[model samples]
Target: MIIRKDNLLLLPEVYLIIASIFYWVNTSTLFNPFAIIFIGVLLYQVIIKNKIAGLLISSVFILLNLYMVLALISELSEFTTSNNSFIRLLVFGVLFLGLNLIASIFMFKKHLVK
Candidate 1:
C-alpha cells in the first residue's frame, strides 16, 4: 500500500475539529461556523493538491491561533488563579498554534521548494 504525503495535511484539520467540539462543549456555544468553513475549504484544497490555496487557508488558521495565543498570554494572570482552567486554556492555545504553524510550514515548503 502506498501512502500519499498530502494525506498528512488532514492532521491539522482533525485537531482543529476536535478542538472546536471541545470549545463548544466548554462554553455551551451553539456552533462554530469558522471551524466548519475553514476546515472544509482546507480539506478541499489539500485534496486537489493546490499548494497556494492550502497555504492560504493554513495561514488564516495560523493567524487566528496566533491571536488566541497572544490573548491568552496577555490574560495569563486572569486564569492563573484558577489552575485547572488556566492549564486547559494554555494547552489548547499552544497546541492550536503549534499545529497550525506546522501545517503552514509544510504548505510553504511544498509550495516554494518544489
Candidate 2:
C-alpha cells in the first residue's frame, strides 16, 4: 500500500476532533470559539492551494475568532444565576463543540487531503 502526500493533512483533523470531544465532555470550553477558524485555515490551505488566498482567509479567521472570544466573555459575564444565561452558555458551547467535530471531518477530503 502506498500513502499519499495530501492525506497527511488529515492527521491533524482527526486529532483535533478527538480532542474537541474530550474537551466537551470535560467542560473545558477552550476550543469552542475558534474551532471554525481552524477549519477555515485548513480548508484554504488544502483546497484553495494558494498562499495569498490562504493568508486572506487566515486574516479574516483571526478576526472572527477574536469576535467569538469577545462574545463568549460578554455572554458569560451576564450568566450569574440566571436560566437564560445558562441556556445561552449551553447553546453556544454545544454549537461550537458540534462545529468542531464537523469542521475537522469536513476537511477530510479537501485539498489538504487531496
Number of the predicted model whose lDDT against the real structure is largest: 1
RMSD of each: 3.3, 10.4
Per-residue lDDT of candidate 1, residues 1-114 (tens digit): 776765564565555556655655666656667655755775576467575675676677677767877787887767538687788877877776677567666555666554
lDDT, residue 99, model 1: 70
What TM-score does prediction 1 earn?
Answer: 0.65
lDDT of every predicted structure (CA atoms)? 0.65, 0.54
TM per model?
A: 0.65, 0.42
- The true-structure Cα RMSD of candidate 1 reads 3.3
What is the number of residue pairs that collide in model 1? 0
Model 2 poorest 10 in a row by lDDT: 105-114
Q: Per-residue lDDT of 5-107 in model 2, one digit per residue for the tens?
A: 6676455445444543554556656656555455445554655566454445435544554566677668777766768758778687657645643444344
Off by over 4 Å in 1: 9-31, 80-82
lDDT of residue 61 for candidate 1: 67
